[model samples]
Target: MLRGIYISATGLKAGLKQLDTVANNIANINTVGYRADITVNSGFEEKILNYAGKEVGKLEYGVNPDINYLDLSSGKYVPTGRNLDFALVGNGFFVVETPAGLRYTRAGDFQVNRDGYLCLPNGSRVLGEKGPIKIDNEELYVEKDGRIYNKERSRYIDRLRVVEPVDPVALEKVGGNFFVTAANNVRPGNALVLQGYLEQSNVDPNREYPALLESLRYLQSNARGLKVQDELLSKAVNDLGKVR
Candidate 1:
């Protein structure tokens, strides 16, 4: 009876974790450059089985109930009319300078800062091959090759630094639509940049929202199952105590 209760409780807890991941995906569905997370389940086998004081025996264990977190996949890109808005046409990341240090992002939404510096909406300076590309005038041009040019001077300012980490999953997503890579990951040597476009979130809200709802329902059902098991256990314990 106690074992049954433990198993049901584990199920309920795992269901809740699945629901949490689904809810997070739904919440970020509309976020620019957001990647949706995937969850996987793993099973564990019983170490030993003691059946009603009989000899301990080994039985083929079924899939153990556990949730494994998968990496977020790349999302699709959408076009925006803004000139500074950018996106990656292929596999790569744009470098940005934040207070914490340099970071990467698929979000190309950018604007010229007060100091005539091209930067993300959050004021993180966009990095170029030479360094942060500073625009002195409104007539600025960025090429697919990551070159920054000025119309007034007709000169190339710098090439944007587009680094590709060896393992994308090794990067950490910081707030403001940027990613920080692990210490060992190599810095991307070259990355193509697209101007006048923005990468949209990969999450399909229409699909994820409903799935999240279903997970919620599953969690509730499991909770009810656990409660029922708990009640039965309580009654059994009470009855056993009363037996003289």
Candidate 2:
């Protein structure tokens, strides 16, 4: 009886965790460079089973919660017709200088900062191959090779710093459409920068939102099983133990 209760409790927890992940995906559906997370329900360890007091054998156990994986697929590109706005065509992320150090992101909505440096909307300086990109002239154009050009000055400015981690899953999310990766995992990527465009979030509400209904049903079933277990326990302890 107690084992049944434990299994039901694990199921309830797993359902709740799945629901939370789905909710997070829905919330970030509109966020740029956003990646949805998936919950992996790992099964429990092997357990010994006995029936009729005869050693039956080990049986498959139930599932528990906690494992999650990030979906690193890129989203559709949106053309904004702005030179500073950029989008990556392949697997890569743009580096930025944050107060906490260097962070990686796929969001390319950018503008020139007051100090003549190319920066994101929040003012974090965008990194180039040399360092923080400095764009003093308004007339700028980007080539397919990711090299920035100054049409007015008729010279090459700088190449955008695009890097990819050895394993994108190892990157940590630090809020505001950014991810931080280990310095060692940073490597040159094969992605081409598409000027005048931005990448949207890869979340698909049509498919992901339906998971909520399934999770809710699972949770309700587990709760019902747990209640039945509790009632059985009460009957066994109080009624069956009576001296009548």
Candidate 3:
């Protein structure tokens, strides 16, 4: 009875974790450059039930949630018609300078800061090959190769710092559409920079809605199982233990 209860509890925990992940994905469906997370569950270790030194059966514990990984799939390109907006075509991430440190992101919804530096919505300065990009005027032109040129001044500015991490799976998400990684990164060979566009979130509502329903059903089933186990345990302790 106790083992059954433990199994039910584990199931409940796993279900809740799955629900949280799914809910987060749904919430970020409209976020720019957002990547959906995929969750995987694995069964716990199986133990052999022995009776008088003879194996009777094998008992497996409930499921456990494995590490969640980013989808890494490219999102659809959205044309914003804004010069500050940028999007990547092939691969790589735009580097940004945050107070914590340097971070990588695919979001290119940039704006000029009060200090004449190009920055993200959160004010994180966009890094260029030279350093933080300074936009003195509004006539910014970005080539497909990520070179920034001022059309009015007819002068070439710094190139955008786009990098692809050695191991993208090792990258961890920081808040505000940024990712941090310890792996070495290199310039991508085929990534194209498109001005006046942004990358939409990779999360698809059609897929996420069904996944949400499935997660809810799993959670409800686990809750019912937990309740049943609790009731059985109560009956065993109270009614069954009563003096006849």
Candidate 4:
């Protein structure tokens, strides 16, 4: 019965974590270039005690909650008609220079800073093929393949640095649309860049809401199980010791 209580408790915890992930996904539904995270869970391995080669008992069914993996898929693209707006239509990430170092993101809403350098809303300089791109105050024109041209200067400034990591699982979200990856296996991406457009969040409400409701139901069931287990334990300690 104690073991049953522990199992139910673990189940409750897993359900809550899953629920939180679903809620976060819904919350970022409108964010630009946002990807929803998925909660992964693993089951506890049964522990069997052996008494001099004879098995005594086996433990079962307690779930082990695991990490959240980013969904890495592309989102819908909305045309902004802004010269600096960009969107990636395939697998890739735009590199940005943060204070911590280079971070990757899919959000392409950019602006030319006072210094005439292309930067994101948070002021992170957008990295180009040669490094941080320097521009002379001019009208910006970017081709589908990421080549940037300064209309006023009549010169090609640089190429936008869109890279693909070896594996998406190695990337971790530190907030906003940025992702940090430990793997150094990054290469130039093949995705086409759409200028005058921005990528929207990838969350789908119809799917996430149903999943959240299902997790809530599972939590409620586990709560009922906990209540039943407590009642049985109470009977075992108190009623079982009573004399008629």
TM-score of each: 0.82, 0.87, 0.90, 0.88
User: Which is better, 1 or 4, measured by TM-score?
Assistant: 4
The 10-residue segment with the lowest total lDDT in model 3: 44-53
Expressed as tens digits, the lDDT of each residue in 33-116 for candidate 2 is 788888988765323322235555534345677567888888989988887789998989999999989999998888898889
Measured with C-alpha atoms, the lDDT of residue 115 in candidate 2 is 89
- Output the TM-score of candidate 3: 0.90
lDDT (0-100) at residue 62 of candidate 4? 75
Ranking the candidates on TM-score from highest down gives: 3, 4, 2, 1
User: Candidate 1, TM-score vs. the true structure?
Assistant: 0.82
Candidate 3 Cα misplacement greater than 4 A, ranges: 44-60, 183-189
lDDT, candidate 4, equals 0.87
lDDT of 4 at 146: 95
Pick the lDDT winner.
Answer: 4
> Candidate 1: misplaced stretches above 4 Å?
45-74, 189-191
Superposed Cα deviation of residue 244, candidate 4 (Å): 5.6
Off by over 4 Å in 4: 43-58
Candidate 4 lDDT at 189 equals 92
lDDT against the true structure, each candidate: 0.72, 0.84, 0.85, 0.87
Residue range 1-244, candidate 1, lDDT tens digits: 6666666666666677777778887777778777666665444523233234455553323223344343455677667767678877766788889899988877777788989888888899988878888876476677888877875648888888887778765776666767787756956555567777787888877777787878788778767877888899898889989947
